[model samples]
Target: MGVRIQMLVALTSLLALFPSLTVTVAVMSVDLGSEWMKMAIVKPGVPMEIVLNRESRRKTPTVVCLKENERLFGDSALGVSVKNPKTVYRHLQSLLGKKHDNLQVKVYQRCFPEHQLQGHPVRGTVYFNSSLETHYSPEELLGMMLNYSRGLAQDFAEQPIKDTVITVPAFLTRQSEGQSCMLHRWQV
Candidate 1:
């Protein structure tokens, strides 16, 4: 976090030298991990800091539980998952972009054994049969998580975060990386 702050400070200083130019920007970086995800921001006028979740934690559990009509994320979702595992989705980064029958996804399914994993007959990607009997693709679930992360970052920065760099697992296929809105982004 300090590393980005150094560069951001320089940018702000340059702006100070030139009072005629007005520019404001904030960049967020996300580490999309299987077990936990972290977020940080580089915004002018303040030191770069890790974005905190609702619980004010540095890192949030990579979990989401859709219980009936209510939705939960991070620690709250993990707590609900303990009782209603079927409504919870975990290891989202690991499952994204992999074939439904891929060995890695198979291991995840066998290890978790909470939600029912099935392959889309056409897409051949993995989707979970939630407790509500809704079929949710990994990409869709990940999008929810990313949206949640975006909210956290935006709230912390106190402004809209337009440019974000999300770091993905090295093992993810190109398709998985492409699934997100990353036309001008990359993993790591």
Candidate 2:
């Protein structure tokens, strides 16, 4: 009887010590790659799961399309890239928080012939100009992609996810670091 009581007490103390073991929260991890983006979710007592987009793909192209009335992201953006090259922005990771004259910006312009790049007046940050008239900053475009990934994670987890962990490349410049901070703030 004493052993049984001691065992129960020990179990209760362990549970109290690790309350998170009892309760589960959904956390989404985003791999913000330059060419593609991916999201995965972790839930208590379950293995980490990869969240797929609407097309049932594990990875999504990092692209955004701006139409006159609406904005499309990922596959939708890529779909219109050929038809509306000037309005579809791709390879935005290189332009975020970068100067207009940066060598990388010039390279991105050459690589992604579908989009037009310009510099913001005050910040000198790179921006994409759509065919219609809207100018989208790299941060804003990145925000759209992040939101899309978050939506996918939410759909898979069947709950609202508030915690997100974003991973970036190791060889990132100060401008890229600033862009990551901006993205972090946007998520918050």
Give per-residue CA lDDT, model 2, range 1-188, as digits (tens): 99999999999998888756444678999888887989999986779999999999999998887777788989999899878777777777777778999999899888877677888899888887764567788878877778778888999998878878788665455555456446646343
Residue 150 of model 2: what lDDT? Answer: 86
Candidate 2 TM-score to native: 0.78
Once fitted onto the true fold, the runs of candidate 1 whose alpha carbons sit more than 4 angstroms away are: 1-23, 131-133, 182-188
Residue 83, model 1, lDDT: 82
Off by over 4 Å in 2: 1-23, 131-133, 171-188
RMSD of each: 9.3, 4.5
Candidate 1 residue pairs in backbone clash:
none
State the lDDT of candidate 1 residue by residue for 89-130, as single tens digits: 888878886777789888998888877888888988788876
Candidate with best TM-score = 1
